[model samples]
Target: MAAACGLTAAATMLPLVLGGGSGDGARPGGRPLAQAPPAKAPGAVPAKAETCTDPEASLQPSSADGPTIDRIKKAGHLVVGVDQNSFRWGYRDPATGRLDGFDIALVRAIAKNILGSESKVTYRAIPTNQRIEALQEGKVDIVVRTMTVNCERIKQAAFSTAYFQAGQQVLAPKGSPITGYNDTLKGRKVCTATGSTAYDALKAKSYGAVFADTATAQRTVPNQLDCLVKLQLGLVDAVVTDNALAAGQAAQDPAVDLKGDPFTTEYYGVATKLGNDDLVRRINQVLVDYRKGGNESPWMKAYRRWLAADLKGITGPPAPKYR
Candidate 1:
């Protein structure tokens, strides 16, 4: 949280020093503090609802029957879990001092569909490894943090239909002897975020790099961007992350380049605590409409704004698939 938003412990405490304001209302300086949106169980269902996934391919509209949706409506906002590091996906924009990126736009769309206002979103910055645990612990209502859906994660949380497609790829400094995910990694000090599939892949030795001896060379960090930082500071030889995120990191520093063709296929999904089928369904509904086809679609507009360049010619909101 502190790292992603660049907020210090003092940043949070400064709020308490200044006296009375409503939840996330005006502070002494009038800037709203990040606060949990006021909420409770709603007496009725929300009349306005929307989604960002392929609507033509989506199931019938979101029933919005879940207790989670009711609680969110009554609270008057949606609490969304997101990333503050991965570029173009969910990083904080320094120019505006606001979290802005592809994933964040999706989160805001969910807030709008459910709460009738995009600004009703309360952002929670979570690290890569903590995304699932945060959802289970109820730290945030739903995690839209570029989390990849996979069998191992399904046991921990319920996921909406796959909303975005990503793949594991290697990132390294430009002009480095390392050309890609190959023999070049035989003895390199590679870095991956703790709890990410990229780290798991390294642990499993799935990249075919034979170790000369049992000296641990893998570095792990809490956020994917930290690995990039390590690379920049000469702490690690390379970073492994989703192509979408790696693209963002590369943009952050032109000296770095996505080192190779993606080595794995993965899907991104909105996740909730296991068995929260209600919340899962509601989020799935958001995905469905958000991807509705056409240049006018919200998803496309956001893509053009943030990711079109990094992703190059790749087309679309990966076809949606339900549980």
Candidate 2:
């Protein structure tokens, strides 16, 4: 995903420290934090009438149902998992020390509809690999970490409708002769994140591009300023990564440029724990509303504000399949 709004770890850490308690505040030592008092057996009637009101009263219309929504209502807040390192999609604001990005806008919209306040959102910065695991373990209520929804991931978690469309692109020095996927990569070394789909796709194509398993393709460069630094320094020939990320790298350094068209398409989705239909439905409803009336909602406004400026010729939300 492109780094439009900047969701950085240092930005998210401020909220974590202010909120207090260990991450998630779940029970320690492999036990529930506080077990509920023994309750009457199933089919038994309650002794007193329940006083809590339906929190969904304020939510927009939706047919989907699940426990994720209920949990957020009960807790009076929404916990969203996101990536801090990716520049446009998510990153930290050095000035405010808070997490904000295109995905963060969606999280705020959902929080406003559910909690009636945007401040109800609790941002959790997670590594790319931990996005699904965090949701599965109940460490977060939702994962907005630019996750791609595929059949395999579906088995582990439910997904909201697609919100972004992306594809793989190669990053190389500005004046390199390599221009497209068909170019000879036999002797060129490519840097990509370990276990990333980009690696698999490149390998499947038998491109003969050497692979460097780094934590983030952006960091594989010798310095933070230029992804082409390695190539300039003769450390590597090119960097293979997503087009959006490649755009970020090019924007950061004039010496680098994206080569050719994207190699593969990737759809971005919000991830929830497996079987958490309620939360997923609620989020889907928000997306539906945002895309309604042929109007750009606040979420899209934020997205455009941060993303459009950097990705020239790219504007508005992704297509229906991606939205």
Candidate 3:
């Protein structure tokens, strides 16, 4: 299959960072940190469990400006939290040193709608575990990373309507005995990004895999790319992550490929600090226009340019659901 997510020629040839170098997400010979506290920040009211039946249903789209939008406009730029290590989703181009990918394209679209210039935006690299913290701490105005929309997450953050549909899947070497997400992985070393849904899924049912973070072996990493590194170096037998992201990893290495069908249904969305309904609603509006024009829509165009080859058979973006 053709490379998915527009993996740059340079990205496919990236040298392996063997020593757990900076920004590589490797933590060789290090122990996983203590469990993080709850997703809600101190003094923040948690969302009632009953209110989150449909996490993907968001406020109706509105172009009217609010305090959040006014502040970003006044500052003349939008601040976006993104991932720079995910090959085809939000990675920085090694050749140009500029962020490019499906997520980055959406960030630029939001900036253009808010500030009249896509370049008038600052990108901050947010780790998978810190996406909520960054938003609650006001470190970033919005997070366009491939964040999943879930009831627990909606309790801590506001999400726009679902932008993309993805699911948990396994990625392993070309000829590994590890079948899909089933018993083939029993007793094997499987890697996943810390605080990711994949980690949660594994915790619920791992088929006897040794995936927990330990003092001797750090199975969890700061970013998903680190899992790929571990797989390449024989440290981990398999990697479990969003298939959307796993597709990019497979593009980077011909030896590895997605092993099975996605095991769970999930939706990707734009996230803001809890109660940032204005920003959330505004983002919904941007997405409304982004998903227009059928196959010619910006959402479809992005898929064709960045994700179609590997994540095939998608006709269009997910329809928006309003609360």
Candidate 4:
């Protein structure tokens, strides 16, 4: 039920100009980018504590044959919720007009395993804010849209093992003096999509009380990529998103670059409906068995083709740990 062309219109995006791109972007664990993560702002209410299993913590395998499998087998297709503007994670390729990215690659593999055809699936383009609610509402069978696992989300939905590692970071114009996650944001307006970790990070004490009584970037959008549009239009000073996503945006627009070290480490997981532990277990096993083919693994091939350059040094799937 997915028309690749329709995803282009649904995705809130900034048109990319791919010419004369630079190779001098930031890299993790090496020459640092931006400033060291700032200390927690004094007396600012801390980010919500995750008292439950971390959303992206390592995932262990499980025997998944159950009703969920029977349901999918009966339907003969997988319905997946994903982002269309997340650049290399999940996006509509302007040239080919097809949905592609690292996450899309995973969807194809899961589809192949369950439905016997990689393309035997329906794509539901969901915004970041609606990811969990869509699952809870029974609107989709799986979500692979750079979703972070956290205690609050587990209350409503289930998540697969950690699939990708990410961290909250800043994006800004080429020569802006905003160094790292520091005072450079005093009078600056930043943008983040609603229902995102980046939005939550902005409110956390350490990243400056962005939403505090003080002056900060007060704008919120429906999609994280829209923040980049605000920056392009000079509507906001910068955009805050995961470094992984910012890397893709930077590639799309040479005018912007990742400005600082990622302030917090996070992980991305596949999300499914609550009480769908059978499906959850099945997905986790899929992840565990994804790369056994070694050099022929689809995960490696896609990463090398799309993500290796932007996310320097990433070479393999995240190791899984079972609960």
- The Cα error of candidate 1 at residue 103, in Å, is 0.4
lDDT per residue for candidate 2 within 1-323, as digits (tens), equals: 12311322233343321123356535222110011122232232221111122111122336454565666767777777876556566767676656677777777778887778988876776665567667777777788876665555666777777666666667887777766555456667766554455555566663666665455434333212233345555567777766766676566556678777666556667888867767767877787776654436664576567677666554445533321
List where candidate 4 sits over 4 angstroms from the true fold.
1-60, 206-218, 293-296
Number of the predicted model whose TM-score against the real structure is largest: 3
Least lDDT summed over 10 consecutive residues: which range in candidate 4?
25-34
Q: Estimate each model's TM-score.
A: 0.79, 0.73, 0.85, 0.81
Q: Give the CA lDDT, 0 to 100, for residue 113 in model 2.
A: 79
179-229: candidate 1 lDDT, tens digit per residue: 666667876778888888777666655345432222554477777777776
Q: In candidate 4, how many Å is residue 264 off?
A: 1.0
Q: Each prediction's Cα lDDT score?
A: 0.66, 0.59, 0.79, 0.70
In angstroms, how far off is 287's CA in candidate 2? 0.5
Lowest lDDT sum, 10 consecutive residues, model 1, at: 41-50
Residue 34 of model 3 has an lDDT of 13
Q: What is every candidate's alpha-carbon RMSD to the true fold?
A: 11.4, 14.5, 10.0, 11.1
Error of 2 at 137 (Å): 1.5
